[model samples]
Target: MNALAAELRGILQGPVLVGELLGRHTTWRIGGPAELFVAPRSEQELLAVLHLLAQVGMPWMALGTGSNLLVRDGGYRGAIIHMGALQTMEFRDDGTARVGGGLPVMRLVRQAVRRGLAGIEDLAGIPATVGGAVVMNAGAGEQAMAGVLQGAFLAGAEGMEYWPAARLDLRYRASAVPADRIVAAAILRFSFADAEMLESSVQHRLSARRKAQGVGKPNAGSVFKNPPGQQAWRLIDESGMRGRSVGGAQVSEKHANFIVNRGGARAADVLSLIGEIQETVRGRTGIMLEPEVQVIGEA
Candidate 1:
């Protein structure tokens, strides 16, 4: 493992940080250090890093913008691949667009809107990269990646490959992409619309979100998935869990489903708060809360 780590450092063209604190990368800003971190810039560099890690059978994980993730206090033992520099987007003469996985979701939305594309306007306030959005099928049922994604380019043990959207089997907040595969880029299809219409749609969604969501603090978006026929926030609020705190982690008063970091919170604190919400809500409503946020690393 040590030998592989050394060799990895020698070959990468992008920045590599050893013992990089994960708190700096995540939205909640509350994780421990990662043993090794690499941000590869191009397809060649990304493939190189993946190949080297695979050769050693070293465990690794990809991090996008870290919008809906949590890293524990004990930290990740393997490589932390940050796909930030793979920011490429090409709009075709046809209605299809090619987007790099690392490009922010809103950035693509804005560009597409300017080009008179309309499909992604509802995804305006979703804070995630294209890759992350596709992997998790990010966005609401009214407008989501599954609605427009044609296919995705991914890198895995078999090297680079394209998986059509049908093969992905995207579900609510999930995709069946092979665990070994990491999304590299995506092919998206959108409808033509007037630029003014797209702009108005984007602004409307953003305004609605701003009114309904908590702001001015660090949060990992919605902490729990809404149960069948029940909104997670409503359930949490009914259970009187809003504004509840565990250490520095608290359920946002404005949005019960959001867990915010009230500064200097630990991963343990967030986990504890989540557990408490689950227990309380379950006891009150007979429905166990399922987390929307992906918790990784060790406790």
Candidate 2:
């Protein structure tokens, strides 16, 4: 790992770290450490780092805001590519917005709302980077990343290329973009609207999300996707899983779909709680819950 880190530092402009604690990067704040971590300075530097990792056949994953992810306690053995510096945002004359993958979704929504853009105002409060949001098709049920996304610049072993929104094959909370192909940048189309109305809509959704999802605790958003003809939270609530805990991890009292870290929660605790909820809900209602949050790393 040291040899690889040294080689990475020599080839890229990013700062490389050994055994960087991943808990600091994720919103849930419960991960272990990454074997190697790099926040590349620019897209070029990111590509260079990827090329080297590929040449040496090392596993790596690009990290965004880490809003919807969980890493196990044993930590990851491969590299973590954090895209924090690619935060440029631009608005064109034709009511379009160009954004970097690392730009925060909150900021993106604010910028669009300020410009009287109506499409992404519904995504106002998601705590995710634009890249991560795009990769997962993040949004509330009424609107999604696919609604505003014209296309994105996807980086792969073949190098970065522009792909249309149709090619993404977006569905409920998921996309076809593979793990290795990072979302570097994207061009999104929006519409002009009354700034006051847009702001009102954004504020309404933000307040609703906070009230429904709860505050004063650390959580990784929704833990499971809503299944066909059913809501996961409703099933969990009906199955008596709300406020249930496995150690420091508990199903949120406010929202049954969320698992929050009460304090000093480990990945094992959350995993155990998730299993219990799935089993209980299935046994009680015959609905097997599917987790929406991405879990990575070794146990």
Q: List the residue pairs that clash in candidate 2.
A: none
- Can you write out model 1's per-residue Cα lDDT over 235-256, one digit (the tens) per residue? 9999999999999899998899
Model 1 weakest 10-residue run by lDDT: 1-10
Q: Which residue segments of model 1 deviate by more than 4 Å?
A: 1-5
The all-Cα superposition gives candidate 1 an RMSD in Å to the true structure of 1.2
Residue 28 local lDDT, model 2: 88
